[model samples]
Target: MIKSVIGLFLPVILALPLAAQEDSDVLFTVSGEPVTVGEFRYIYSKTNGQDADFSRASVMEYLDLYERFKLKVARAREMGLDTVVALQNELEGYRQQLADNYLLDKEVTDKLVSELYRRKQEDVDFSHILVSLPSLIPADTLAAYERAMDIRDGLTAGNFADRAAEVSDDAYSKNDGGHIGYVNAPLPGGMYRLEEAIYEAADGEVVGPVRTPAGYHLVLKHGSRPAYGEVEIAHILLRKSPEADPDMQKQRAEEARAALRNGESFEDVAAEYSEDDKTSRQGGYIGFFGINRYNKTFEEAAFGLSEDGEISEVIESPVGFHILKRISHRGIQPEAEQAPLLEAAVRQDTRFAEARKALFDRLEREYGTRKVDANYTSFVNGLDSTFFQLSTDLSAADRDATILEIGDQQYTTGDFVDYLEANARLRSSLERRFEVEGAAESLFDNWTDQQVERYAEAQLEEQFPEFKALMREYREGILLFEATKLEVWDRAGEDTTGLEAFFDAHRDQYRFPPRARVLKYTVNTAEGTDAQAVAQAAEKNTSAELIEEFGTDGLRIEEQVYEEATLPKGVTFKADTRSSVDQVDRNSAVFYRVVEMLPARQKELSEARGYVIADYQDQLERQWVEALRKKFAVKRNERVLAKLIES
Candidate 1:
């Protein structure tokens, strides 16, 4: 209730600024605290959007609401609500959330997402010979790079497919001469480097020794085509068996195709003939699939159909023979429609990390970061093999030694130690088998990056006026919510005597119109049940008793009270009387029993509690605002206000 109430007035609060120029004219003052003309104008134009006409009436109406809002905010501060630990924490949380969006290098992220979306419109046909790196040790990495370069050189003289078949480490594609066939971006995570290489290469151009996590790639771009986006297909499959003749399997597949051609529904034919257990019950549905998701032959057959509901001739694949019916096809979506998906994909890819690293680098330059190499070397030298065992305690080491300096802030050895201890679980993971010296160096780099990001985050409010304004709005919003809840919402709900008295004074306003308490009974007539017998039982007994007598298998009885205008159109009310049973349809009959006909009367407090409470809350809020206005001193500058309206 408090959030809903505050939401009604949030636009005004959210648009206001916490600070303005010292020389700006004061539009108003509440208890000696000034609200500048700049602040008021900013909020007014923002809250009203295009409706902020400089008309005097419009200005005055908003001024009144603004003054009331300020009065509540002032009262909240007087009560020390702003100093509450919970609210301060909440404000900080909101600040962090807002800062996360602002801290990114948005230009880089946008470029990546846009690139992915554009590339998604066309599928790339590419092949690559991957020389797998045995490890990330310098020698192994250098060897892999050299080997990939050697392969690229050989590709210029010899057949690419023959070389790939003999030497490529990618087992899946090497047999097909490194041809992975058509693929679209965004590719899986950690594959961004390969994805980039594939899309950037020209037709028939062999590029790379590109470095990816898996190893180095020597890529050959096999040209491109407009993407075959996705297809929804149902297929009937006849599996190959050594015991059965190949001709028999082919005959079965042809029979299924003939049934489909003879005007039988694809769903019925597939259920009767498809041997794929997973899809047989679901009408052989394979759902929607795109390139690289299935074998090249199956995908080609499925996407080859030009029209929905078109069936393919029996096609052979490695696993079985299939007769496919194309259910639907979806082409590439427009950029705007695809952007959100592209953005999500980009974030999951390795490129997002590179973008963030770029952001950190920019911040490092701006903040004048300098490393204390001597101190970092000292810290790393002090570590032992126990570091990976989570047993190293850096507390006894040089706590005062500075490892990095960013602007006026110094990150000491003690801070680095704290970060390491905090990440002990990650440091102890089975996948990380780093030596002590190497581990310490890696941790130090990460710690330095974290320090740089923190320093940048700390300076956001000071550096960005828009960020400061948002923080101020959220702070005041929290105060206003707490104040209103305490003074109006909670009081109205908890002060039972006051609520009852208020409802009593306004009782006539909540009187019920002429109404009836009715019991409606429905009986299923399709089973030859007697509708007349059900109606007779409903007239004589209460709904619960009727349910017990009829066993409730085909009888449904409900009791409700409805005003005259709201009752069913043909329903007539009379005390202790039942309406004639009427056939609602061929299979159902309904009757209504009027338990009591009620005339207009005052509603009890319990009968209208929700509405009464809402009204009571409004009354209390008005009184509270009036009291606050009396307590606070509000003085508006008429000359400035007049100028604002004229401008």
Candidate 2:
């Protein structure tokens, strides 16, 4: 087993010195167990990838951290934390999720994603006629394909839309004469086949019986064009109340236009008058948006502006009139820059299933996934109607029957039944319309995909050394976390007597700066006009009394004890004084009367408990790490250390 594990990393192992390669390239030894260079580099890279702080650490600095880490793992294993049932279950669950990142056909995914990125640079507009059919019914499926093919045969540019409106099953597109609008490629969802067909066809050419989850489609390529990219706009809005007159709203919009013509800053005008609360505060700046994102009138007007700082005339929408100013426009980005986003979007889409199906088809051909036609038919027939009912127990004969053979692996009838039972709870309708042959065919296909993924996962460690290293790191990480929680974190929190003693010792270290116990109130006025009046009233009465006298409406009032350092910006004062000061903008003023002064002093244990506890935990962990280091016989090779420093 050890030799096999080492063999998985042969390529990397061969890069090391002959002595080191044969003996696993030992960088260090903890308690006589070797820590290989490959293992250290794997952890170093993983940590550095995720953490900016660690990425900046030099090899020597990281080596110390890594040594401490291995000591913890060693301690955890020695204490048998790795054998805990809950920890094992948690690790297994994490392993399953992590396996997905490693187990995929990445070369195939990357190629498809690249193809998608290239195509996304050009948008396609197509019209289609659908002939829907469920795949389980072979004859019906063929008939749908034939219908699509027939539609495609006679399709002409002029009649395509007319025929689509008359016969297409797509309700939304039918009314628009089968126009599905502009779609970005690799069409998301089970539309990969359609996307491929659309891209391959010339403008005005008819193509199809393209198969998708929605069934067969006869698609007419309307045209393709360079991407429109995205636009950013700033708009000045004049919101009209439902009760307000439309003419007045239009008049307000025109007034805003006049302000722009008169050379007033657009941002200033928007901030002073625009009624759109969302964008008004940001000087009416609407962030970048793609086509079809905004309402029709807004979208059209925003896109129509050709140059930065160009303003649109009054445009009417349901809300009111808007005056749009062009901010900027972006063309298609470089493929390398856009691929990550495109890949992520495509992977999450259901249409990507077609691409996955393509991969599966390729894998099946390569690995020899053979269905035992006779056994498959017999297995389906043998299943009772109760087989569809999730609650009903199934006693499948030939439970071990090889339904599918992928290379040396055989997927059994028992596996299919297991998948079906586990999945059928939410698919109760399957029981009502269950057909042995058809249901079996659909189930087998889905099961085959799962089996393929599992097979890929099993081979990952051997085929990809990085995957093995990563899994090993995660497994140890899990053990370390559980062990640390039990030994350090949980214990520190629970040791109240020790915690209280620690807090008392550190009380003098925690002190509050000079602060104020004060009465404060704020009043808004045009250019600080009411500043004197408000401050005068505050000096004579309490905040509540002032509020009552001032009728409570539109008066801003508050009273809080604040440290001098934590005071609201724009206000500055020494304690033990009454003062009234105008705001920075001179738009408002604050009134304050210092009731008392708070001198700098040591904080009470209760007041500093949270910080003190955190500090105490850190101290405890430092002691624990020291104890672990002493417990383990740690030895580092000077030669290997030198090599790391040189690298």
Candidate 3:
């Protein structure tokens, strides 16, 4: 019975770890339970493949977690909270979610990865010579045309590369004698236009004075070749970066090789001597670089060196001090590796994800649960509740107030909103999202976030498994909104008492930005017109000067990019008073005298009232809900759930 929870792993754990063939010697104990090095090695090999993503917990950690899980399960069984209607329903839902994920594996992802796995990639090799043409040349047309024509004729004559040297104006290739290097090789994706000529041509065949956007290209076809399986080599490098101190690097590389040969660990030497931080820590152990992954200097050194444990002398490159050890090599073709691994990974993920979802759906259908929120409305179906409630006091909050007193604690809604915006956990929670959304809507738009969130959550949960992850994603987003809608805001009664107290306590939050509604005129056709011409044009049309001395400098106008307080850092270009803008657009431009030129500045709270309200509501409701959760007599009873397998 204890085995079922850890069933999938027991064999490997007990087998001394056979996760892979190479590191089958490193062992790890499962807590105090005696385990062997073989077991640890096997786990590490499989896990190492996934090490780039550290989000997933490690095998050792998971083992420790298992111990905690056992203890928790015992406690949960003793409490018997699992039998409560809500708790039972939630558990069943999770179990069903688990099963539905399995079905998905069977239905979708597995098949997709398998199909993609069978596909083949065709590797090709080719080379070409290029000629760049000047755009609309202003030189002597007759002379330039004659020179270009002569080069073309020479290219058609024989030994095109040699002709390219003597006559081709492209100075880069003229010296190299027109060898474009390896086919379809290490060139930037944007610069590989010559591949078309190379791919279509036969070996030793010279083609094209083909004209492309870059220039005229005289291409010689090198035959297409498939990619080699893979290579294995060990190497030591001497780097040549000015920052690398070349002589020191060469000496280090030499010492590294000597240390390796003298029985010191390759890993230790690499960590101490390799200048490249990313690989040096692993003892110069770079897993595998394929195709044109590395630069020529390092790639050649690594690939050209001989087999396992063998080390070469210092090789020079831009990022220097390389000492390498070749572990093993695989000739496994693209199709070979992709097909099986892709198929297996896809199958597993699809089945697990889908079946878990299906299971959840079935459970929900069998024993339904209802979800409720602060709006006094039921958001999810399948439950009974007599009355819904929203805090009446919260509904009346003053958008201008800085500190909202809830019981003894005073909350700064502005401060809370900033915190919420930055919290990673708050942004990711599934069920707690909708209310926050409602708050935001009520702020920027007239829409009430709580209402919108309720409807959205209800509709989405019904669409389960189809968009569960998506719904889960929105669950947090929407709650963040609902939280923005909490009723604590209504408690802000407006009056001398309210305003005086609010102003005195939180007066600092209300600072107004320097603002002006200076008149602006839009000059639609002044494209590249000098500033003086613009002012003259304005004067001629409206008898008012938009700028005193406008000329080539462009129009000098008062503009907005949003509120100054909220303005972005550095030079702002937009209008609206709170924030800075990098550049001004037409929206902030106003066309109108000294008496009527400047407009009054707005108070920050008044301008940002909508935003403040929404943010405040979210903080209130989440706090309220958390308080209620603590008050509830919640318990977890796993007896019924545990009975399933036993039965």
Candidate 4:
């Protein structure tokens, strides 16, 4: 089934020369429409990948399938299913999803990845005193900058952490004296801009008043060192059960330790005694992990072991008692190999905002971006305190006022207002948290990014021909799905009268095999010699009375309907016959009675509706396809077909 479908719907492959061919280089034709070599090859390539069954299919075999497929698609087009509004909307949605894969600025991403890799080589330890400022409010930003500068001025040697604890707005590290421990570039927790600022400062020197989206910072670069990599470890745990004595946990751990000391295998000991169900089954292997993955105590102990097979003494954590063993440790990987990891980390990090801004800045310069300086200031002046509260609207004049010029395009105050309205909730939050002017400025840049991205996406077809080909294939696929539904699936499901007629015409194709109805009785005897009791139970006058007598002392009875071929082994009975057998166990006996017998018969229409409907649809589709084949003229190029096979 899978092979046949693959033969019919191959995907577009850029490397296939046939997919790039002109329409005049036709592979086949249906009716008056030509099926170009490109179309045929694109479909074929989808089913001709390294592991595809169609990779071994003959050109002629696939051509026959493709011809039928085209006939159906052509009929669908004639029926105008492609013009359906719902289908068009669905296709457009798919196009949007596909666009994401092609719309990114790859050049910028690659450059950032490479840049991050170079930075990842060295780890920097830094401290900072942050005075939070809103980006939009120039006044608040200025105040924050002054505060950072004053703090920088007062920073005596060895006093930066103390000042940071007292003054920094970063609650996470403020209480810890603002110490941001050894951050690698792209900044592990994504302080890329701060990392960059740290690199600019000499070791042990105080620097900046540097501005970030978060605030203005006074940085203290303590030192730098070669980057350290991750570690792999395993542990055997002895959990203290809530109702159990703590000493029992300690005793189990000691037993495990004694096993190891006595030269028993660590994996064997862990398998036998570790209380942690998850890792115990895997020989207590805890896999490779980086920093911050486990509790501080566990992490410290795991990393402390310097060599493989080295073990730590039994240690206790909040969860349980554990003994640790180092499996392996690795140093920093080569930058080239680490680029993808850094890129992924950066994308997920808020620090990517800085990199994104850098990209936008470059775009602005390339596109000759210009702000109408007077118009911007005038716009800001017109805004009142309620402006960010969603209580103000742009005046008619302000709506038309040009705020920015990029390349040959002009953006108005109206454009930015629309963006704000579209993201009203986010804008409201930012408004309450930060200064308004700086927020507006950042929003303007974001609006520009949308335009830039749209422009870039529009150029993709021209910039990359392969992307165009791929999209074309998806477009056809979307159309094909809608067309098939209308022509075959929906029609089959809704045509109840037609289905009944089809099923009636094919009644002889459905049947049932021989079957039987029987009762199986099991009786357990207290005396171990009660086969006579089972026989007497089968001979009872009333089922209820017989059950009351036999259904005691582990006795039970069950009735079932079954086909003759599916009846249980070693148990057989003729109609109206009853028999008993002594059990394999001395205390039990078995007996059965055939209640009735059923002969094979044809299944009713209602009984076979599900299977019949599908088969009927297949019959209808086949007839329709045959009619289409006769109406349309098909021509194949044998010479070109042979070339396809060779390729």
Among these predictions, the greatest lDDT belongs to 1
Model 4, range 1-647, lDDT digits (tens) per residue? 99977766665443355545643377777777877766676667676565433343655677788888888777767778778898778777876776673544364566667667776677788888888876567888788888887888768648988998888999988987888676656554645567779976789898887776788888888898776567888899998778867888988898898889999887998999998899998889998876556776887788788898898889888778898888999877887777777778767776566666676677668778788888877876776656567545645357888987877778788877788778766666777556877777767667778876665566666667567777766666776677767777788889999988988889988777776777777777654536665666566445567667555565667888777677766556457567546574666677777777778789898888888888987887888888888887888877776666666
The clash count for each model shown is: 0, 3, 121, 7
Q: Could you tell which candidate, 3 or 4, scores higher by lDDT?
A: 4
> Candidate 3's C-alpha lDDT?
0.45
Candidate 1 lDDT tens digits, 1-647: 99999999887676554223322789999988888877688778889999999699999999999899999999999999989999999999998888885666344667887888888888999888889999999999999888888888858413888888989999999998988888898777788889989898888888888888889988889889998899999888888878867789899889988888899988898899888999988889989999878877998999899999888999999878999889999998888888787888888888999878877888889899998999988877877667776665667368989989999999888888899899987676622667777777777778888888788878877777667777878988999999999999999999999999999899988888888998888898887778998887666676788778766777887889988777765677667877778999999898887889989898899999999999999999999989988899999999888978877
- Give the alpha carbon lDDT tens digit for every residue of 189-281 in model 3: 333335445555667776665544466666665445544335564334455776767677677677777787788886677667665666666
Q: Report how far off residue 214 is in candidate 1 (Å).
A: 4.0
- Candidate 1 structure lDDT: 0.85
Instruction: Give Cα distance to truth, residue 292, candidate 1, Å.
Output: 1.6
Rank list by TM-score: 1, 2, 4, 3
Alpha carbon lDDT at 425, candidate 4: 68
Superior candidate under TM-score, 2 versus 4: 2
Whole-structure CA lDDT of model 2: 0.78
TM-score, candidate 2, is 0.59
Root-mean-square deviation per candidate: 9.3, 10.7, 29.2, 11.1
Error of 2 at 197 (Å): 9.1
Lowest summed lDDT window (length 10), candidate 1: 14-23
